[model samples]
Target: MIPTRIAVIQGDPRARVDLAVGALAPRLISRDAARAHIALAAAGMILLGGDDVHVDVSVGAGCLLEIEDVGGTIAYRADGRRSSWTMEVHVAEGATLLWRGLPFVATDGADVERRTTLHLATGATAVIRETLVLGRHGESGGRLASSFVAGDADGPLLVEQLDLDGLAPEPGVLGAHRVLDSVIALGFEPETTRGDLVLEHSGAIARHLGAETHTSRLDRVWDEWVKRARQRTASHVDKPANEAAVGGN
Candidate 1:
């Protein structure tokens, strides 16, 4: 079966939703205060062989958009075919986008490919989170190829690719880890702690690799980055009001 496809666009200074479209079980769940939440409603046993899902999102100048998943997505074992999921995002100047992705589990014999591409204009910001788990307890996982590319009008901000197999330990890739959690923040420079991968560009990536119990390694970094991003956005939003107040006085 073909995977789900979803697209959303937010425009105007008020951050109103200008367009929204979805197919194959992914739909907009709610909207409030310039924020929209999308949910994946795929029924039991998702992302089987030959499934292909695509999501496209666009945020207009000065708009804000948030996306989330209702629950974890499980990729069942494949029968010699590959399943894939891809997301493409575009953020206009001064726009902000936050994607809270839930866990993706790959069971034994599963084959999956996941990819994301982000394009940002000057002053645009984006925050994205991902968690990949290899198999459930007591079972070795399958094969996965995960890749991400992000850039702005100026230049490329990040490009990364990982090919992993749960049963084998690569020399330099994931080593012996079974879980990988990551958070990517772009368009702003925030203070980071040790272990945070600070990029040359105005962004940082924090990742955790280990058993599921080690997932907390990314919690502190993710929380701090999210807080900083929200604060920055709030300041930008309040700047005009403050300037107007001063002018009136």
Candidate 2:
């Protein structure tokens, strides 16, 4: 599978970012000394049949990166064919990453597997937003296997996996709901305490489930968590200056 790569590092004049095109095109939308914004646009039709896609991203120490998705993706049915998508992310010490992703819909007769993993160093921060739709309008959806794994320098933060098939609808799995929206913040505490699960490590995940995507209540959670995540980035950014001042004295 051809892979898409994006990386950012601290530089003298500004932060330098690198990008390579594969299934998705990574375009630099905006940048400053503190953070760089990149938009991921689909290069062509995706996840039709027997397709595999991979994305790799890295944020260097003392730098930040923000990613935006241009559009959502829908998996079209391909006569019992299977597809897969995987993403890997790494954040160095004193770095931050923010990603806002669109919906990933699995249509009827489609089969797809997706996995995402995150690795964080000491004092690293990350906030992620994801929306998973089971099917299109009035459709029973297809087979989906989704996994999320995250860890820090000390230990693992979160590990979750779900297997949903359109043929079965039960009480424990989705339970008549078609949408699952989640907002995750790592290396910081969320200001909102209610209706969210705090991880054993340093992080929180706020999730919402509903029949429809428009009525989902995760927008407020996303805003609050993003605010808290940005606060942590500020402290990481200022540490080097403070250390230099101490060394001079």
Candidate 3:
């Protein structure tokens, strides 16, 4: 059994969840009242051969949503067929969404395809983090193709595709590496002394292609972006109250 899809939409002041779940689908573990969002926990044995999963998320104007996964996701050995995972996200003007994704591991004989698309309106913000690991401890992994596209109301901000196979020697791509970790930040740009790939649009992307231990290369950038995002959200949340107080005075 595999989970087909999970959708989350922002209501007046909270987020609503709709699940199309199977026996092996991830379950909602906890909800944060202050954040007005919920967390998801993966269930027993997930993502076997021919498994397909989709997640859709929308944040209404002026709202905030946060999503996190409990642990890493493993793709078991697939004889021939492949497993697919897709995620689509939409953020309205003045809204924000933060997603903390766990690592994805592909064991030997596994084939997987992962895609992510994000659309943001003017004044909206989004932060997404992802890590892909080819194999487990000492073994070489299988094949994985990952695609990501993010844009705002005006036009596309970033478009990228990464193809990786443990059987192939990629001197130009990974070059003796097994991990690809990245973070995408939209509607906010931070200055960094280190090298970071700056997109054509307003946001920026930080990526590291090396061993799993080097995944922390983007930690500083991620931390700065998250801090700024939280501050922005706090100010937005207090605006209405501040206005009301001024009116009363």
Candidate 4:
């Protein structure tokens, strides 16, 4: 397990960071009075059989955190075994989380479980981009079971599960598609919803399932969604009630 934590108070000039690195290394790329940019790099071979990777993220009130992946992740063959990856995120009121993820490829014979859990306070927002690729050059991919859950103090916002184990090519599933790309915005809907499915709650997800990564053509949507999220976070005005009392801290 690789533990990474960062926070910024209402009037703080810098972000406080804590870390205990394992298979992944987290580094602060840049920071300021209102925002922080960080990056995650792979330390060594990962997603092998019996490997369990966990990530925990927290954004303080009135702060903004942006995370970028240095490269992509490739899950190799797991010889009748399995690997797991989990991420848990908490966004405080008036804060925002933006995660820019690269592609994740599962090679032949690979079996992996991926899970994400998100918690958003009132008025908080988050934007995420992810691309899942089935196989490498010329082979059929392995099995992947992915689950996601997101909610706030009021109630549940989103919940979904995708099981590709022996069901990748099913009618409702991938079905001859090797790539599944998505750009998701939570806590608020973006400016556009063209050809995208709107969530039941105050959120939306733009997805593209195609034969190849480039064929998805979701980069433009990602750019627009990210811009919208940035604008919202930049102008958010709410802060904790005690912010005035602890402004000097």
> Local distance difference test, per candidate?
0.73, 0.83, 0.71, 0.78
TM-score ranking from best candidate downward: 2, 4, 1, 3
Tens-digit lDDT track of model 1 for 66-176: 666767777888899999988888988887887888788888999999899999999988888899888887778999899999999888999999888888857887777
- What's the C-alpha lDDT at position 167 in model 1? 81
Model 4 whole-model lDDT (C-alpha atoms): 0.78
- Which 10 residues in a row give candidate 2 its minimum summed lDDT? 240-249
Model 2 lDDT tens row, 30-82: 55565677889888998787988899999999777889899988887958789
Model 4: per-residue lDDT, tens digit, 121-206?
98899999888888887878888888889999988888889877533466778887888999889988887656887888888899
Reference-based TM-score of each model:
0.84, 0.92, 0.83, 0.89
Best by TM-score: 2
Task: Name the runs in model 2 displaced over 4 angstroms.
Answer: 235-249
lDDT of 3 at 45: 69
Candidate 3 global Cα RMSD: 6.4
Best by lDDT: 2
Candidate order by lDDT, decreasing, is: 2, 4, 1, 3
Q: Candidate 3's residue-wise lDDT over 2-89, tens digit each?
A: 4444444444333454555442243443222123343555655666888877776767666666667777788888889899878878
